[model samples]
Target: MQRFTVTLVWVCFTLATFPAQAEELALTSTRTLAASCAACHGPNGNSLGSTPTLAALNQQYFIQRMQGFKDGSVSSTVMHHHAKGLTTEEVTAMAAYFAQQPRQTPQPLPHQSFLGAQ
Candidate 1:
């Protein structure tokens, strides 16, 4: 009876940790996915140029814009192609991730040239 009680307790304890593990895994996956946007959107979605910042954006708005891009409703020079490649789940995850980030102004790059002229 004691052995059975010990096993039950161990099983319960193990099961109790599964949700935390799953949450951690989800967060890691989301972060990995969000990292891909850093190239154009700047780190944590703070844009450094003319590109619109994604940080602290409304989640639903983000999802809608991405969906619009995917469906050809939004015109873009590059976003449509990028948006088309993302699954709905990926878009949602990215939206949620961006929404949670605090928005910050990006500093201008040193010695930046305009119109390709030095």
Candidate 2:
């Protein structure tokens, strides 16, 4: 009986020291939510077009824009529909996630001299 009690305590202690598996579920959820933005915003929010990039955007700005979209205070062509379904927690998570990504600055177009230029 003494040996069994010690073994049970050891097992419980080992399990408690290890990280919980629930972390993976949280990562999966964040990934799933971010994927929804890839179509227009580019993968991981590094947009390669006219759309504003979400990567490295200020957290407060991101939240404000998202909340605006959700509340219909921000005018957008499509974001309103997308933002409508997100919970506040999800928005914060997404903002933090995207803010960690590296932002890509768009390059300026090359200057072309007119045919009449000297």
Which residue runs does candidate 2 get wrong by more than 4 Å? Answer: 1-19, 105-118
TM-score for model 2? 0.73
Model 2 Cα displacement at 95 (Å)? 0.5
**CA lDDT of every candidate:** 0.93, 0.86
Candidate 1 C-alpha lDDT tens digits along 32-118: 999889999998999888888999999999999999999988888899999999899999999999999999977777774577655
What clash pairs does model 2 have? none
Top lDDT: which candidate number?
A: 1
**Candidate 1 weakest ten by summed lDDT:** 109-118
Q: Each prediction's TM-score against the native?
A: 0.85, 0.73
